[model samples]
Target: MIFVVTPKIPHFLHFTYGSRPSFSSIHSKNSATSLASTLKSISSSPSLISHGQQLHCFILKSGLNFDVFIQNSLINMYSKTGMFSCARSIFESSPTLDCASFNIIISGYLKNGRLGDAYKLFEKMPLRDCISYTTMIIGFAQNECYEDALALFREMRLLGVVPNEVTMQSVLPAYARADGTRINAMLLHGLVAKLGLDMNVVAWNVMLNGYVKGGLVDLARDLFDEIPGKSTYSWSTMIGGYLQVGRLVEALALYCEMRRTDSRPNEVMLIHIVSTCAQATRLLEGRQCHALALKMGMNFHDFMQATLIHLYAACQQVELAYLLFQEGTKDDIPCWNALIAGLMRNGIVNEAARLFSIMPQRNVLSWSSMISGYAQNGKHRLAIEVFHEMVGKGFKPDETTMVSVFSAISGLCALKEGRWAHQFIRCNSIPINDKLSTAIIGMYAKCGSIDSALEVFDQIRDKARIVNPWNAIIYGLAMHGKAEASLRIFADLQSRKIKPDSITLYGILSACCHAGLVEEGKSHFRSMTAEYGLEPNHKHYRCMVDLLGRAGRLNEAEELVQNMPMEADAVTWSTLLAACKMYENIDVGERAARNLARVEPSYGPGRIALSNLYADAGRWNDAFLVRRAMHNENLARSLDCGVSRLCNALDLT
Candidate 1:
């Protein structure tokens, strides 16, 4: 707001006044005392801007305002109080500025997430050092401007500045965040190697994590082996890596090695191992780890407790899962869901329902767990009841519950119940997508209604959803004595570019044997191996034997059994024995029965088929001995006796 004055007249007036009356030295002491008092008062009430303005006027009157300590104190007070404009004024007015002063303002701006202002001040600073650059880069990365962070790092390097380990550690994860086949990750690792930053344990862990998250497990392992010494994080990364790829046994071994090496497994490592144990279903190992975690005093952590609940449930130790659930202090929704799911998994649906009802809070997962438990337990009515409650409570069902409930109703063969559920789904406009339709088809098939099942099957055209439905429909048709219809379904599945699984082939092959279509069955079996790349397991081989045996080709069936790469299980040998019964080949039947007995002496189906073969051959003594052996083994013969039928009579009123 000042204007320029004529220099000659101003200089003449200033010289005359300055020479005539110099102020007494006594005034200097008063000025000094006043400025000191003012600085002290401002410092005490520094937060008040109005007081600061009055103090500014007093300092201008005292003419002792340039005290560096006072200026710095004012800057600190304003910056601390978030009065950046006032803080910047004090900073700009200072004639003597040091790195410390610059750092204070820069840190203030950075802390407030005002990176633009921070960068501007950083550029204007006369001194650029490691701490300055580190602060800026950290702010950039923290703000998620990773590219800018890297660019600043490059700028630091070009200035012939050597970055310290902290510098490398801050920016390394930025490369991980940028995606290009993980090239940035690899480049960063190479930079670390070239810079010899391995002595920095933090840097090494970051690189190890980069490799892990980038899916370079081999590279991660290589880096792991080369580490001068590994820490808990290093062990966790490797263990987690093995786990991510389902190499559960390897993960276990590493955990053991880690324990042997005396690396104190912290809470995180324990959680990872617990999850791995759950996946591996190693209940005993999980218990051991649980004990270790308790000894280590990490038992109170909510994450560990949740994992313990899941592990116990997966091991089918629902009692232990409940015990943990009871002891847990933090009962999150997931914790409740895990306990409920565990109970359901162990077929303790009644207990699951009890727990679910008492849950303080219920989300979709809790409801789904209860529904799934009832459905799997063949309590289809209860499952549907839960679904209705879910809808009535305004909790919309998810896909998992839909699929699970549909499957349960189908398994129970409750045709009326299934139809009612179907109608409800339709009225509510629930998607009758591939999964729902497949479940319906499975339901009809279970009820021995092939035509209705096939009608539902015809509607699914999506290849992804078609294959599974086709497999279900085929199995249903084959079990109902309509083998030809099963084979035809399989053919249609194959024609639509939807590859069938061994299960589909298993059904079709059995159907082919039942219908005496040996050639077609053989062709389909071959296609399973050649086209689908499916290894013919014992089930497939058993179906092949049935296919051959039904055609009166006993020798081919025997050859198929003998040529099995693995030992034929009870089902495989039993299928061959059944063929012997149908073809009346007593000698082969006896051999199959003996093999079957060796495989599983107590299986009722095998024992009955063998005993009947001896009876049909008039080997009454052998048949009596077989029955005696069965009785001695305490294997009861399943009563395939006639089941009484109920006749429904309609009365016209």
Candidate 2:
């Protein structure tokens, strides 16, 4: 005989056995309670399948095979063992199923990253509970399906499912990941308040983190202040929030406050504080943090060492960074890369190269840093060589690496390499973000391919609606002597409400100079300070001097150079001298030449310009004297190149 009892609970079934005869007497001797206990014990064992199979066989033989209790245990064991198919097979083989069975299979699908299957099983469920909804919501959040997570949260609320703390925790982070979800975050905060969970520290921290990530630091700070008993995570989140918005002073102040409190600083807090110091350029504060780390015995830790290296490097103390790098373990890649990048930033290329050669391991960052460093420091050939070497080493280049390579190609005016990079980007389906698009435009422009540059500019115009590509296009057009087109682009930029920075004004002024638009250049120069609030830097001053000098306003150019707030550089003097040579103005030309020679005695181009100015005026003796000075300075080769350029400019070959 057999007996079955249906419990008052919604989804639980209990089975019991009475005396049985013949083959069914195997487990009939043992009670159902004892058998269920045995099955649970088997589920906990290390080798689940072997023990579970024995239990299943005994259940079948003992005539208690259809017990829901035993079947549920089997599903759990299979799921735990990562045998989802077996769990599903058991669920399907069962004649009766409940919410518990569906929940097990759905969770198994989620665990195995089979979200589609999980959702499918969930949709087919005859009954759903809080656990079912919460599981799916958490799964969506974990997978970065934030919209789906929030949508489900709303639906859960609509269906009168009162969410517990876990549901709120799962859904809050989804809002934090996106900027447009701030309103949703605030609404959730209100819901938490209505649910009387606002006082909960975990809830408070989640809300604070969401606000911080949404770029609402003030709101985050307000909420943070309301938390009576803040946790370490709360303090760190606030500090990181301030740091994210570049409120370095507030971040430091908060750190100081955190130190005064009973809560001790942890690794996460220390890392953020060190970063704050670096951003604020507070070397003294950074040293204090370093001392604290040492006192806490975290100095030699790989992550702490990397942060310290970055801090010292940002403070322009490369030697300190190097010392830390050398003192730390050699196997840490981040430490090595930080030191290498620091050396490169300080223009210590040879040392950086030496370190790169001996790096225990190299990643994309190492190669990208080396390539970018060489390109920025004007070692374009070496940069290109390193890029090709990185490719040869089978390291796939990311966007940053490609950007550096394109910049180097631009510097060398290597059209072939530039074309190949563009093709590679397309073939690899690399997203043409604004930075890469600007780099591509610059490469084409600098390589004397204005049409190609313009074409790229038009292609990315709709998507890359930023100032960088505009600057690149305008500068390229200016370089190619399309002054009108450059100005037209500048006008369009203003019409689009895209404010021009100093680089944009410089490009405009340069276009004016190239097109001999003196009055236009003067007006734009004045507007740089008045309209755009951009004070004329040295480059702007040089452009103005060149403009005035080229228009034969020699006296005004000289006066402008003399009265300029900043000291004129060698390029400024050279530009005036070149203009004088073009116009054969010996009086002002001699003054400009004298200044140029004094400022850059070794600069062969200036000397050649002065010589050509004399030659144009038939001053053969003076021209010969300039050549003799070039010989005296051992700049004969540079003089030869300069003379060739001068001859082409003056039609005097």
Candidate 3:
């Protein structure tokens, strides 16, 4: 039998209310019914608190104040109006109460962010139900107290209280938020299926969110297909999952399928899709999302507007990006940051600065964008200047800002500044995670401190698990002509069972080139496709050509170029031609020069190298012809390709 305590409000009110206004006549049934209706309506609108107060006065006079229902309504009214002191006073004074009386005050505490109070009241509750458990669970989950929420769920299960749809919805997200709880999610799924909530779309969506967040995209897709009635949220969860894991092809395919369905997408989902498109530089899909947003009349808020500006800039449509920024709410900082970041991405550094200087308000992100943008555009000195300015203005630099600052210091090869940044990172106690560790290593390596790079690499706990630190050390060794040391590091990486990525391959190949390791280079080139399933790109092939040419393997180098699936570009031909010139191989050098000219008619380096090769070989006539062609190429093209390319984020230390 459910417990129900008898109320002592009549005795409590004797002292609590003190006195009541004299009623001219007895309260009729119509008056009591009207009062009940008014309280219910007033509960939803906090603005009618004064009107509710007037009703409270009427209650004390009508002798209906003893009613538990009337007291609950009054407590609810005060809670909704953010008058928690009054709500708690009524709750404590009432001796007689039911389950709802506890639930109401508990919900009031929860809505007001008083979890501790809510839990205390719940423990004191004379009776509890599914609502009580679910409310507490949701409250804990909202505050990121996932363990507490899940514990309460277990307690509810142990008490034999059946979970409703609301309970499942709250519990699924709680488990998802907690790390190492994916297994618990499966158990919850079994519970949900047993309870016959399998067809519930909200439950399915929450479960799908769990799978996505757990990095199990394939499992999420499998479950997503099983969902009977897919909602807009379902599609967004799956699409976002794919994007988060960098599965752009899969994300785009799913997006196409979503478009074919009848469900209209929500603004947040569309906004995220647009944002991902910007990061991947997928211009076509980004434009499509923009058009759809316009057609669907999604709210043009600062964030979405900023994302659009970033998208346009990423696509190299600078004018469109500028126009959109001009038309947006200029006062909003996000739109301004987007415009500035876009300019940086497209190598419009000066324009980004101009806009950054004039923005009405500046946040930490605004300062970060400027520092990163300047570094990206090869203005390392300017990047450092902006970083100091940001700190002078009292904006504490976050990890991301420090990453950009270290990058600029690396660019300038300023050992002093790099050391200062390192000291600052330690003083601030920033966690040296994989990305920051990699950046710090790269900075030290490029600043002519290979020993420091190795020290940083050794200090990282995830050095073997992550490829970046290994890459930095190997590249640093190769840069310093410690080719044997670089090779040994690669061997150590293999022994650790660490899978090497493209950057790792580049570092090893460069190491081989520096050490003149013909056999080692050939073995790696073959293993790239044979063992690692990695196809060697143009750069890899260029390194091989330089190695083989330097080692007098001219025929093999020529054959590799000829058999490469992709056409040999200017860099490849230049490498081959340089090798040919070293060995005085006129036949191969001529072939390389002709191909280089065909591919890049305005590349002066290829033509100049060919002329030098001829002049060194005493082929005066051929050298004169090459010089004339270079002169004509220069006259035909006013801008050098090299200069144009370097202006757009191509600087290296």
Candidate 4:
């Protein structure tokens, strides 16, 4: 029942022996030849595993079971089809196996993402040959098991296996992914020189990428210069290395040099340079490349077209990007995703949504792009809606998708939606690390759920995650009338040698002012200037003024404001004026109002505070005069509702 497809040959065949010399004999020869040809074709076509199996049956029936070529091909075909059980059976049953057979099986397993199967076959291979070892090493490296790959390479050396060009090519990439230290990379460089494997392009590329990725761009260029008989890959590697590290000018220069050398730019070179131009936001440079691509007649390739979309989007040329997208002949899903993302980048949310809705095929990237676009445009509701639709379509979101969704929920302050995302993440066993966990805490804090924020903060064992989570907890506690607790946390941060940033100091100072801890507030203000060497900014000065004002020490607060090195703006003077009104200190209130009017001539709060002081002092005519001035200036103060809540809760006694 086994059948293999091969090229049709006319009137060719083989026979058992000289049985007869008739038409049947001629036809039989042709049939046998066709069958053999078919077997050869099936062996190479990775998609014909089922047909290759049928050919295997024919080989068995025709007594060609001992044919080494036939057996090796069967093993390779089965591995390609992910029929590892069948490949194993053929491999074990075959009395003889060569390095080629082992390599084929290992490569196939690696391609199929079956690392365990690759390792098992590698273990069973005889001779511990270099090809076999290199194949498995590459498998481990590609699978991102970098540490294991390095361990295996070391074991290869312990077995007295001399490292060859193939060995260096396969194992050097593992070092790059591991972010191996400069010393470690230098050690590998020495090994390459000692082994005389400099001509190994893969090893050299890996090392170059390592240095570029590690911000050792100078070192990478030095190595590139030393490379003898540079190939197109060498030039492309340098271009990409420079591009990766944001050296757009260097990458472009290298690309020009590559062209001058008559090296034909490939898809990789085009994508790398175009991406760099996009990042640089150089619209003019990108247009030249677009013209060059058209001249080179590579405008139709999917990768090149995708880069064009990205380039136009990044340059903020939405109209031009749209025109290019409309003219695109190819309708690949990636092309559509790129265009939609471009539209989103330009703040054309409606256009992006339209394109997203009509996309013929939507993958995770496409779905995530739409969701992120909605979130970026402050349309979180639509973002959540699209995410739900994506999930309904059975598209499982990855970590990137989760991060976007987390951001959307936080932006909308939709804790209920955030809970759903959390549930999905938990059910899927996604690790709640700093990025996602911090977003969750931030969402709760924004929604006025300090208790929830604290609960999440407590669960985090690493204080070095970010200063943000600490800022959230401290500010939330201070706002919720827990100044003592907030101050304790701030002290703890100092005790642990965690240098508090401006936000940290501001939050703690505000808490002290609200709690009427004048001494504690003064202590912090002095420490901030004298101990931490942090120059008191306007915010810090304002907090200090508020501290004295709330403690009914109006004279001291007025003196602080008067002596501020920088000009006291409306906010600083307004705080002092509000404090004066609260304590009914008319003299200081008038002085603060005069200072405020000079800084903020059109400020409604300044006029209003002055009017309030006049009304309290029974100066009806003066109050009316300030009101007329406010009316003439057309300065209106829309009371900030959030700040109103804070002020209402404050006990200014």
Candidate 5:
């Protein structure tokens, strides 16, 4: 509320804030403490830096800038606002500098990401205190020099400077992010307890986050239950951690518990819950969450709206999802992306594309949404086209977008384009993780470059981290008719003690099918339940039926299908019937054709195979009868009509 009394002083005081600086108050300003407090308050906000500079003019007018406290405050204000030269000028002008003077400048440098400069200044300090050590430690930690941060903390402890809650808070993240074997959550918990910081919710929250990031959700949950007077961050962090690690049921339960508590809830917790319900396709719970958000007046938040849309789309309630999107602000790009992603998730790609075309404004995420949607729906040409269009428009593709683009490239089997995409990922310096590795390896394999795929697989420094690349290589080898080589890779996967998932089993079974390795396929199928403890899903059962039927083990294949836990799908019967036609087995062929008819009555291939089997078995009347039935059902179509199916052609010849 300082007012300008003189015309020489800027009129912003009067014109902007409707006040003027009073010279009488300036003349009577005697208390340096009061002036320092005023300076601190004015300079604390980054938005008020202009006002802070104007106040400095008044301080100099009154000759109070000579005060060491006033000098230090000015340095802090300048440094906080990124005016390092101005801050350093004030520090150099101070005739007498205290430890606080160095602390302010050093903290400013650290905050500005000038870690080396902060360290240089720290080394020159004539004397240091706990706050000085804490500032440097926090600086190193924030700058991701985690080891240095922890080392400094140890030195601080050795110097007998007892740690405070802030110190514990600063150092806990370093421990959490450190090598897991070197850390014990209990050791830090005991240290925090010994410091009587158990009630320090921030410290506890940090510890909870540490445990979650370390992949020890059980420990995090134990600490979460022990936390007294939890904050919104506490609930949000725990719920988010639970969701991140795939503990959906528990996360939902915890949200219900949070709602039962007397404490106020934040928008983040509900958003996460709604998003989780979407992922799980729990439409009932998602609707309940929507009702809760409305009750708490949280539904209007942008994230909540987007997540509600995602929830509806995931559950196949696309109409409701689009209705929700239309009911809200269409100007919001994230909600639009969410709706588009939802459509893609529900297999409504054309609707997603239509909405994307008309968006008033689009961010990088919008383009990425279309790219990812097109890739997911097997519209590979559209995916690549949109990607080039986005690039032409000057939007750089992020990792997720590149992954989708690579998938599209793989679908086209464009080796040159795939190589360019791989080079682009490297040139852009995108860190190659498991999913990216899977995508890149798959791209190379599908593009008719198995050698490049193998090179990529071998270059993975830590291949044992996940079975993703291994699965890709195995499946790719199988697809390339290198079934024995694929089996060898599977053997290596098992030798490394890497647990093969259902997809891994699928790849192994596919290798066996491709090579007609009946005994090996049967062994692996048994090991699925006995060794790996993974129950065979429909894909596994289907692959096995194909393997046995291809091997001419018609009786064994039929038995396997008969004993299947679930009803046989059309593809399973088609596989068996095709094998029967190849082997001229009338009994199994007739049974498979009947089952295929029951499952997919409009399918023509099953009838064609049956007629072919009858003709091979010299049953002309039966073959003629099958052809008549197909014609009656309108299954007899023109040869010119092109086939329609997924573009993911797993041609494991």
Candidate 6:
């Protein structure tokens, strides 16, 4: 006989036992017994709450409301339906209560997250059982009060309450969360084996998960392999462990092994595989995983879709990424950001901008991606434009955004914009970290504000001033001809025990070149390999050549070029050629010109330098020959403006 509750009258009781039992027919002991039996049956099913309610009304009408069994059943029903207030009312109004009564109400409170109330009522209980302790232990773990949960489990043990598999499941996660609790978890594992609970699949999965979250991937893998029959969750947990420690290859191998087994990968496992593919940049494997996802009918999951988008983008497969984005729901901001960032990465700035314009909504990530994309592509003006648009639309830029905007300003040499960015950083009280400080220093230096650059450098705390910012400051001072100050800063950097990198030595060499400190330049250049153990690259060699050649020591410069450990690239030879042009040394100039032309015949700057060298030395025929060669090679048009300026300066025309 089916029993149902009518929603038209919430308080009224109706029964469909064989035939509908009317209110008039429900006034007997047998009828009341039947009604109470139906309520007990329906109470466990939360969907039958209305029917349970109607049964409760009938129980009251039959004078069974004061019955302990019926009232506890009602409490259980209300708690299961998430109607905690009604459950509490029944518990408080009960005249006769048992340990079952306390356990029911306490479990309700625990399930409802009323931990304080659960603890209070637990304290007031006259009798406690293993179920009582287990409920509270699980409650504490569920609420993330790991310490309290462990403390209570110890207390339960002290009271001689033997823990079952459920108890181990609850307490194991607590151990995972607390620090220095791995030993306790291991001890619990031993206890579980001793208690013959190790065969319980749920208990084993919990132990494996505990080890994973505790960052013990090796132990987790060991435990995982020991499991006689692993579940999908077991595979997922171990895979996540490997990913956490950057063991992407192992993660993928395990995932592939899982696929070989009968265990079907769920949405979570697919997401992890996709993420592993992204991190490893394995496009082929990622595509196979995508195909598997489609085959398994798990592509509808929003998170999995987002992860796949990121995976394709990371592989530099922008078209595939955009196709995925269009195929999925576009409302997810992360998916949008991933596509935009991917487009920017492939240098498709216009497409990225177009996508950014039509996004349904914009977040900090959206704006930051566009700004960074524009800046990275050398569209500094567009980058600044997006920054302003972001601000005018009331989006507060984050530290990353500020850094990109400052970089754009530095590129454009827009002092006004640079000053505004600095002010914005100051007004917002943004913490000046190394990256931002370096950007600020570079911006001020490029904008011809050496004092502001120095001020920014001075404001950096000693501990926060790393090598990069020091390089910026030294390079800035040297570029503006503050050679002595630049060298002083380098000395300060050394005294502070900050090690100089290749770029730092390059800045010092540049300072020496500008100040004509040929001896200092030579000492620092030799020290690059001697004291610092830095193998000087071509840039370092070029700087040295420039320093010596500028001082009219063209012979020494030529010798340095010939004996360089690395091949002197075109730039190094071009530096010597320019120095020759400056001092009108035809011998070294011709040699430099020959090497430059050989290294890069298509490079216009090298040809122009050679032309200028001939013009300066009154070798008109030789100069014309170089010019005609440039014209014959179709290089003159590209360099016409610079060559025109050089001819006008030297009255060659």
- Which candidate leads the pack in TM-score? 5
User: Which structure is stronger by TM-score: 1 or 3?
Assistant: 3
Q: Which ten residues in a row have the lowest lDDT in candidate 4?
A: 644-653
The ten-residue window of minimal lDDT in model 6 covers 1-10
Per-model CA lDDT versus the true structure? 0.73, 0.80, 0.79, 0.74, 0.80, 0.81
lDDT, candidate 6, 341-368, per-residue tens = 8889789888888899899998998999
Give the per-residue lDDT of model 3 (tens digit) for 1-653.
01122223222122213243223332444355445555655666666566677668878776677788777777777776778788788878887777777887888888888899889988988778998898888889877677899999999999999998888887776676564344665677678779976347877887788778767777678678878889988998999999999887788788779888998767788788888888888888888888887877663777788889989888898898888888878788998998899889888888889988888899999999999999998999999999999989988888898889999999999998999999988987877767788889999999999888888887883444578878888888998999998999889888864678878888888999999999999998888888888988998999999889999889899999999999999889889988888998888887776777667755667666767888999988767765665564453333433322211221110
Tell me the deviation in Å of residue 391 in model 3.
0.7
lDDT of 1 by residue, 216-262 (tens): 66666777776667888889998887778777777778888888886
lDDT of model 6 at position 373: 88
lDDT of 5 at 384: 91
Greater TM-score among 4 and 5 belongs to 5
Using TM-score as the yardstick, the better of models 2 and 4 is 2
Q: Is 1 or 2 the stronger prediction by TM-score? A: 2
60, model 6: CA deviation in Å?
A: 60
Per-residue error at 598 for model 1, in Å?
A: 3.1
- Give the runs in model 3 whose Cα sits over 4 Å from its true position: 1-220, 228-233, 244-264, 461-466, 495-498, 607-653
**lDDT, candidate 6, at 14:** 39
TM-score of predicted model 2? 0.60
Candidate 6 similarity to native, TM-score: 0.55
Return whichever of 5 and 6 wins on lDDT.
6
- Segments in model 5 whose C-alpha atoms lie over 4 Å from true places: 1-223, 226-234, 241-250, 326-331, 344-358, 461-464, 495-498, 631-634, 637-653
Q: Number of backbone collisions per candidate, in order?
A: 0, 0, 1, 5, 4, 0
Q: Against the hidden true structure, what lDDT does model 2 obtain?
A: 0.80
> lDDT score, residue 449, model 6?
98
Q: Which is the leading candidate under lDDT?
A: 6
How far out, in Å, is residue 492 in model 5? 2.9
